[model samples]
Target: MALSTDHFSPSPDAAHLRARLSQAGLRATRQRLVILESLLTLPGHPTAEQVHRQVVRQEPSISLGTVYKALDSFVAAGLTRRVAAAEGTSRRYDADCTEHHHLFCTDTQEIIDYCDPQLDTLIREFFAAKGLQNFQPHSFSLHITGSKLANK
Candidate 1:
């Protein structure tokens, strides 16, 4: 299917997304691509509702249930991940499935992605020295929660 979206240069192209979906054993549908686009473009870690709203702007006929289904399928396929939300708040989804940590803002509840090579090495070395008993380690990411201060 040919995708006619102007947000194709910096944003993920439909072809790449389709390939990813196929690799993850998912059939690449337009609805799913639009939903994934929202997940990747929306500020912070967006909830299912947020994605649904963004998707409807482009695809008016799409339903909330369909968005939820697409999100769950993406998570199961390792194409995206479900980030933990505080109690009472809705669950948030992140399109970046890379090995990176998150900086959560307690004041506004915004989630920010953080990557530190040194930290990754430190964590790996520490875990390598003191391994967990009866459990093998695959990856790790630190979620730090705090308010973001104004730029100096």
Candidate 2:
């Protein structure tokens, strides 16, 4: 099956993700690849159940448990990121493989990508100025809550 790299670039990072999976001694099974590829194709974040449903359409043999395991493996291998949804009821997976944030709609519980280099710089500067020695901020996701009707 062809892997979709539309949202995510098929650059060196792609190889790095694959390499990490390899280093973990993962055999890169077809099901695992399907899971990863699905994540890569989706523009918005998706829960494990959503992913499992999509995978089932292609490979009916794939189970929800298997999808969950593949998601764990991908997260462990740094191939994907599991993000908390608007309601914090379920986790969403992002395949962009970059440092970014999210904008969430409270009413619909929808999430949108939030990316800004200036924001990233400001965060680092703020931490540095405050001399935050205890907390080392690696990554951050800001869930901006707003009503969908307001947005419309």
Number of backbone collisions per candidate: 0, 0
Tell me the spans in candidate 1 whose CA falls farther than 4 Å from its real position. Answer: 1-9, 86-88
Residues 1-152, candidate 1: write the lDDT tens digits: 12112222356788887888899999989998888878877766789999999899999999999999999999999988888763337888877787888777787677777877888899899988897799788988687777879899
Return the TM-score for candidate 2, rounded to 2 decimals. Answer: 0.78
Model 1 error, position 111 (Å)? 1.0
lDDT of candidate 2 over 87-106, digit per residue (tens)? 98898888756777777778
lDDT of 1 at 78: 95
> To one decimal, what is the Cα RMSD in angstroms of model 1 from the true structure?
6.4
Clashes in candidate 2: how many? 0
Question: In model 2, which range of ten residues has the least summed lDDT?
Answer: 1-10
Give TM-scores for every candidate, taking all chains together and pairing residue i with residue i: 0.83, 0.78
